[model samples]
Target chain A: MTHTDNGFSATRRLILQGASAVVLVGLGNLPFGLAPAFAAANDKYPEEAFKAKSEADAIKALYGKTPEASDKVKMDAPEIAENGAVVPVSVTTTLPDVTSISFLVAENPVALVASYKIPAGTMPSVANRIKMAKTSNVIVVVEAGGKLYSATKEVKVTVGGCGG
Target chain B: MASTIRVRATSSGETTEVQALIQHPMDSGFVKDAKGEIIPPHFIQQLTFEYDGKPVFTADWGGGVSKDPYVKFAFKGGKKGDELKVSWTDNKGASDTTTAKIQ
Candidate 1:
């Protein structure tokens, strides 16, 4: 009886400790919780975008509208990426009120790789290291004033980033 | 735990360039472990860069990004000795922040 009681108390203590940790994390009580409510209203990550198999479908799911190629969107990527695992991709736009920016890899299993929200007054430029399964046309989309614009650049990958 | 986010900022001309590397597995659920079991997806979901408490850059990342992801960006109005703070939150609800002085 005593052994069973001790085990039960230990389990209860663990449960309490777990609950407190979660509460502290959620409340941003830790030093790393600077912006506790960073995206409370818009933290809804698009589940459909990352699961999309085709570029068009991913763009459709993300913006609910088709994107048109625009000269205002500038995408800078290597003509050939020596390493597919860390292809440097950057996008800049002259468009105003830029709301969102996304990168799509044509040949990856899933087209949408990364998407970012550009808050007001911040620059509409972003750079990230993205993985490509193979040589593919990288598409960048920028949303501004409720309209979608895009630019594409073909990057040749010598090595496959996704497992062979 | 010590902050795993490493940040460096340098000023050139009128813009301040910031580069950061975050230590993370960035496991994609599609990958299998050595035991052939699927590794659950865990990645940094959001990363924010602040200059003196004002947000200058923010990113929404997914698992497709490589492990120990690196990001580079620049803002127009940064000066020397200014504090550049970076904070990130992973899908598991864990967060970390680190600060660097602009050079």
Candidate 2:
């Protein structure tokens, strides 16, 4: 029993030392750990796309061109969002070659709420729950025939979701 | 490790509707924690839906989304027993994936 007691203390001390070493290593790599996370998040997409303050600018930054209002695209949203945090919005199009669909909440801090890439043979329709900072126009941009088209609808919200 | 996602997909009338509920804090980095410290940004940035091997629907999300994000979207072509894979990557470099079969 006496011999085993010494071994137990030795093992406990070793574990404590190992934990301290791990903590020191983690502190040493703090800068590297945090930098890659931010780089990865921003590197996946253009920084300007999300920072665009207006719907038009977001569309341009996202698609590299302005969109024209077209009747072929259908934008659907509630006349009033009961909950601004989860406003259901959808876009459908009858146009051929619908490549992508994007949603923008003009009143939010960041205008571009969502951008969807629709592959061929898949439906040209998408539904998503987006946050509306306030009462604003919900814009849907669709890319078809190598051109950009858009549709807009106003959604009134009583509660602001963007940090409100 | 990131949180889990529950996915369900059903096909009807030549269309498949996919719905997924992702468990996440969705910290906007604007909210403060118990100690008044700003919770660093940790939210799913992108989510992708794939059928078989092709990408059908993808979403670029931000931290403004509510907690425990729920998303639903539909696509044109899908059949019963077809596999639908949903994957997501967060700002913290954590990722999660789950799959369901069209019913």
Candidate 3:
């Protein structure tokens, strides 16, 4: 378990320079005075989005837009999860110019499980483990070419992950 | 005093696939304890992977993530022996960063 503060100090500039560059898709204008502030806003942890209890509100807060159903998005997950505490889920997309990917559990206390920012040169695919409170649909959203597209699948949980 | 992040980055000539497993409670604040007391929320809020000083992947996570989170992804153009930096910051302001070599 070796660790160091070295990585944090070195990457500080890069994080502050902020890769919210992907979200710059629709800001339209960037004034000199507000440039720094705007960039910071893009990189900051999306507190509100993660706090949203409903799937719709979480997506709106995270992307500020609605997604259309897309066949291009492919999601893989078990039809039944015996342990809701750790459900394996993965999403991959054939959509071009994808900028981000997000996963949401409609029945979880916080609907938004995770949102990933995809920088250029990175593949538009991700795999992660999420908690499910009950039998519910898991939605995966992919933001490609400045538009949002989504796909969902229902996962039956034998045990609730939140211990609810 | 150990790093909570473990990462494996492998390059297959053209693209590098990265898999990371992090240690954290990821408590959603909705769970109860043996005494029926609610466990307060504590979870990693953001995780980033960088190569050549550029961020290739960034994840914004919530309490819904499982304990000791694991994530996998890939990026183009990383060569063997090159370095990849993985770091994470939690809701409580605790963070750790580790450097792994692409194999």
Best by DockQ: 3
Error of 1 at A117 (Å): 2.4
Worst 10 residues of 3 chain B by lDDT: B1-10
Candidate 1 per-residue lDDT over residues B17-84, each given as its tens digit: 88899999887566677888888889888888888777777777777788899887777778899899
**Candidate 3 lDDT by residue in tens digits, B1-103:** 7889999999999999999999899999999999999999999999989899888999999999999999999999999999999999998999999999999
Q: Which ten residues in a row have the lowest lDDT in candidate 1 chain A?
A: A33-42
Question: Candidate 2: misplaced stretches above 4 Å?
Answer: A1-44, B1-3, B30-39
Model 1 chain B worst lDDT window (10 residues)? B25-34
DockQ of 1: 0.36
Report the number of the highest-lDDT candidate: 3
How are the candidates ranked when ordered by lDDT, highest leading? 3, 1, 2
**Residues A1-164 of candidate 2: C-alpha lDDT, one tens digit per residue:** 99899999999999999999999998998988986765455336555787788887888888889889999998888999878888888788899998788888888877887777777777788777788878998899999988999999999998877654
Residue pairs of candidate 2 with colliding backbone atoms: none
* Per-residue alpha-carbon lDDT of candidate 1 for residues A131-161, written as tens digits (9 for 90 to 100): 8889999999999999999999999999977
Candidate 2 has a TM-score of 0.76
Report lDDT (Cα) of residue A161, candidate 1: 79
